[model samples]
Target: MRPIHPNAPGHGHSYSRSHIPVHDEAKAHLIASANHSRIVSIAAQKFRRRENVIARIRLVLRILSLLLCSGILIVLGQAVMVYYKHKDYVVKHNGTPDLRLWPRGLNMKPTLVMLGASVAATVASAVLGVASFSKAVRHITRVGNVVTVLFSTFCIAIWVAAAVYFKIDDFDKTKHYDFLSYTCARRHDQVLDNAVGNLGNLCAQMRASWWGALAESVVEIVSLATVVWAWWVGKRGGKYQKIGVEMLGSG
Candidate 1:
């Protein structure tokens, strides 16, 4: 006389309302977890791009810095060679590439002092580049950048002084009728037998020094600045943390 049970013999059994809801809730939780996990994964993937971009930029800057350092050496060497080749002719006339404008302080090779400074700066920059590639130590990069900045600044100052000292003489130019030929006359060595070679050598040195000071120096400064910027960005103190529902829940 009691109401027939659903599971009674020959009776078809259907899911109970309470049990059905339980299974539905379990399935819903699984789906939600999967969706949330995917979203988190996607977000993480996107955030990684920012780091990648910074790394790529840093690499490019390192390459450029290396090239600039090389330019400093190559250009300065060209200038030095020009002076060396023609200086013998000038030396006989008691002419020195002396820093006559400045009082003798170190008793060093006057014209070579600037070139030496450039070598030091370029070497320091090259060392920094190597260190950056080998190890990304934050303090090291900061210190390196400071050194590079100071050296590069000094380079600019010396470049200006050297430019004026090595300028072409106007009176001589009028006489020689050519810039290179005039610089040769300024050498004050009339005893040189090879007139053509003397003019060419003196003129070459003058132009090489001028171009090194003007073009290569500019690139070196820019390279130093870029290195500093890259280091600063690479050692960023702040990170952009993305707020997420999962993080909040976990908190």
Candidate 2:
């Protein structure tokens, strides 16, 4: 008969190792901590068991993160187009949207500022999601779960600010209603109704920007909730207590 070691995987029936018990006071505490953190990891892992609620939440968060990225792209792209379209238009002696005057420059544009924040948050979310998915990189996922709340909060604020401004200042009840459709509407039409080419086209671009910003904001909020909950389900004491006990029982 071959000698059987306690740690061997298939020796459960032959050289049973269930008799051992952890007697070291200090070692027990350390093993418990490691096992607790392991549960947290599985809760956030991409290929985790489907039955676990935390794993399911993490999966939803992954999808939302991807949508958030797309939304960021749409918002930024529309903003850029609208800014350029009205580059030459003026409102009450005020020049139109331009990047040169944005923050880091003496003059700053609120919409542009929001756009920048949204872009950064989107990138952070993407990296965070990727770290969670890869599993191969454990440390990155841990760090990401820790800080994602901050970035997601930033995204939510900026998005809501832009969306609110769009609804209140751009559209109205009737007649003067400028945004005819997403593809066409007058930007500051109350002021720039005179812009030379296809004012409706400008309107469409602006509408797209608003929708994109709003959509991402909602998605980020949900993602934040899910991530926090996931951490909660993973970190609770009991999840790892069994593992720690098992480890102790193994030898």
Candidate 3:
């Protein structure tokens, strides 16, 4: 074979170092991509954790609201029972105790209004609470949340109205009837005393129901705030994730 020249096809230049930089660049690129992927994964995990936390908080609030409203409903139900019992007693006795002698205890209209509100709130809370557990019904969950918020608002208004009416009615009845002072003199008459006692008990129940309504309204407002906070967090996280994905894709 002829002696190979320096610049020949299979000569001194056969072993080349130019490919080293390309290899290093490829390795660096892979490492950077892997790091980005890890960062995204961590972010996603954190976001899911936060989302779960919010969901749990909301569920708890919903249950609490449900319980509160249920309590209110029970109280109002007792009031209604006492109210009807008093009417039946008066009719059966042919007004022997003379209802006009006693202070009017609970106004029927306001009591009914509060009762209805409690029922609505309780039902809404139950439905929404159940929906929250189901990830497959996201649309329904969103709609339920909106309905709950609306009901909360309406409940608050009605609660306030009923409470104010009760307050005003109580004041008027107290001023006109003056039953507290009359109780001493009427104690000798068993029927009158029993009638007075029954009315007094009914009034107490009404007061309790109105107070419970106000408390439930406050809980509803808190629940609404949590819902809004959860929504904001989810929206913000989604925006950040989108931005991160865009950045990774460009890179």
Minimal lDDT window, size 10, model 3: 176-185
Clashes of each: 0, 7, 0
Residues 1-251, model 3: lDDT tens digits: 87768877765664465535787867776776776677677777876777677667766766777788888888778756654655545412664643443345623565566678778777876786677676532222476457656766776777677667655544563542222223323446656555646545555565677677778778768767766776776676677677666666654
What lDDT score belongs to each candidate, Candidate 1 first? Answer: 0.51, 0.54, 0.63
For residue 228, give model 3's deviation from the true position in Å. Answer: 2.2
**Tens-digit per-residue lDDT, 1-251, candidate 2:** 98888668865545333443445645766776677567646544532442255444655665676675566566556756654555555444446453221112211143455466557656776776676555432222455555556666876776787567546523554423222222233334433444444455545555566676777777777767756665664454445555645755552
Q: Residue 164 CA error for candidate 3 (Å)?
A: 3.4
**True lDDT of residue 185, candidate 3:** 30
Question: How does model 2 score by TM-score?
Answer: 0.48
**TM-score against truth, every candidate:** 0.46, 0.48, 0.68
Error of 1 at 132 (Å): 2.8
**Top TM-score hit:** 3
Query: What 10-residue stretch in candidate 2 is worst by lDDT?
Result: 99-108
